[model samples]
Target: MKMFLCFFVLFILGFDDSSSQGNVNKAIKILTKQVKKLQESNKANFEATNMKIETLKNESQTNVKSLDEKITNQYETKVLKLENLIEQTNLTKMDVNSLFGEITNQTEFLLKAMDYKLGILKVGNAECSQYNILNEADRGISSGDGDNCDSTGLNTSPMWKGASWYRFLPPAGTILSQAAPGEDHCGTWLSGWCNATLPTVPGSTLDIEICFDYSGFQCWIAYDGKVTNCGTYFVYYLDNIRDCTVNLRYCGAN
Candidate 1:
């Protein structure tokens, strides 16, 4: 009887041990499956993120290229127009002034576009000075009778008060002259003129005259011309009868 009881106790303990081992094996298998699934999910997410980043980078590059191309084309078109205008021979003084004004505007546009494309900073404008109220007896030329702007022979007050005359001297080493009309009055017109003395042994001088009609309220420019070696002296005149404004640019070493 003692032998049988010992045998039974041993059998019971062995069975419990076997059952526990089976449960542990099943749990391990489930955990392994979960870990593999998690790894696959993480890898897929990483690859998708990388793809999105690459796509955005390519799009950004394409957009920048397109913008640069557009700006370049526009600048080229403006340059061609200017060249054609300059090549014309039958241009009047008024036509020249208009061309100068157009050149100024186009140059500004080109500079800005170049700044954007090349990542370069633009230079500031050159220094300038203005002179008003000329001596009639010395510098005034009779606009002849019936000329409202210059006929008075005496410079009036500022343009806000009425008609006036002004002189502008650009900085030394100026390469171009710009003279344009200013304000508008009833049945009145704007006029511009320029005189530049070259820095040569003979010291030749160039004179330009321009006239604009104000019948329909559109302002006109009288004259525009180039001034090389304006290092000695340059003088531009305007009838500021609400008809002229002054600015000097492109001044540097000859």
Candidate 2:
């Protein structure tokens, strides 16, 4: 603005006369210097503004990435916590059942151990109709006599001539029909257990089905109309004759 006013003053003076010609020339030089300075100042300001804009843009991008990562981590954490909670709930249910078994029938539990199959029996006294594998060795009560049971030891039959405690352990699978008398046979309760979490309602006995297919080693353990455990551990194992049984039973709930 000052340059414009000075140029106007110089024009007015020059129009007055050639007598002030020297002063007019000096004014022109000063105007030229001011214009050059103004151009340099504008160039510097433009560069500075562009740098600020670029910096702001970079900061915005970084903030967006950070926020996205934070949100993703939070989501994963929540999912893991929910999974852990569900697992704990299932474990607690089993714990409660075992606790009741301990309090109500210690001997029965000792005989049954971790057996899954039940003898759908007409019992004298029991909370549910289905009962774990209890036989002449334990109580002389079973679903089928010797065909599905190993009652030879207790004087029921000549016996298949094998062993006991096979169905009383973790896998409660029965391979008696498929296997021989003594070698890990599928006796009656259906053997081949797969890696499956047993779905259960809290504070109740788990009436879940666990089946293991040794062919391809696929296992399905389910309860409450949902499949729980399905993996390598429970489904397929033949290396140690301990877990190489065909645990096939009713496909799904009837």
Candidate 3:
């Protein structure tokens, strides 16, 4: 009986040890599975975070490129506009210079013609005082009155008739007739005499006499006229008048 009781106690002790070892083995397996699951979750989160970072980098690069293109386009447009303005300014300056040159040439020619007329008048007076017949012929018979005259004693008519002289009848072969009948000649002169004829081209130095029939007022060309060699004399005259009056305004003599 003592041996049997001892054997039963030993069996109970062995069974308890076996059961504890089995429970330990099961707990170790469950902990290992949980560790594996946590590792996988962490790896997935890391991949998702990396993808978001890459997306943000790509978006920033695209935005920068777009902004650079817009800036480049704006600068190019501004440069083009500036170039156009410069070209326009250069053209305007050239036009102004050309007009000024034409006016200067006309003025010089007019002055020289007046000086020649005065010298001729002086010579004629000196020669006439010594000889009686020559003086008589110069005074009464064949001396032309103004600077521009024919060999005959008859007075040469002006090219344009103003309002003051419109009523007066011109001699035969008159090219233009005056329109206004009153006492003011505020229009253009359209006759061949006023224009340069022999050896005279457009813009040539010609002696032009502008007569204002007003008692005390004189008329002059308002601006320089450009001559053109059109077959029709009337057309050439009109073109010259148009150029002469380009910048003219009426102002009463004080």
lDDT of 2 by residue, 1-254 (tens): 77786767767575755467787777778778888898999999999999999999999999999999999999999999999999999999999999987777765543343333343322222223222222123111122212232233222222222332122212232311121122122333333332334423211322233343333334333211112111111111111122213222211110
What is the per-residue lDDT of model 1 for residues 1-254, given as tens digits with 9 covering 90 to 100?
44754665465455654477766566557556666777788889999989999999999999999999999999999999888877664466678899999998888766655663464642221211322323222111222112234432333322222232232222222222233223332112332223334333111234444344333422333434332222233323333333223211111111
Candidate 2 is scored at a TM of: 0.34
Candidate closest to the true structure, highest lDDT: 1
| Candidate 2, position 131, lDDT | 22
Q: Runs in model 1 with CA error above 4 Å? A: 1-19, 85-90, 94-254
Where does candidate 2 stray beyond 4 Å?
1-15, 96-254
The global C-alpha lDDT for each of the candidates, from Candidate 1 onward, is 0.41, 0.39, 0.36
- For residues 33-92, write the lDDT of model 3, one tens digit per residue: 666777888899999999999999999899999999999999999999989998998998
TM-score of each predicted structure versus truth: 0.28, 0.34, 0.33
Candidate 3's C-alpha lDDT?
0.36
Sorted by TM-score, highest first, which candidate order results? 2, 3, 1
Worst 10-residue lDDT window, candidate 3: 132-141
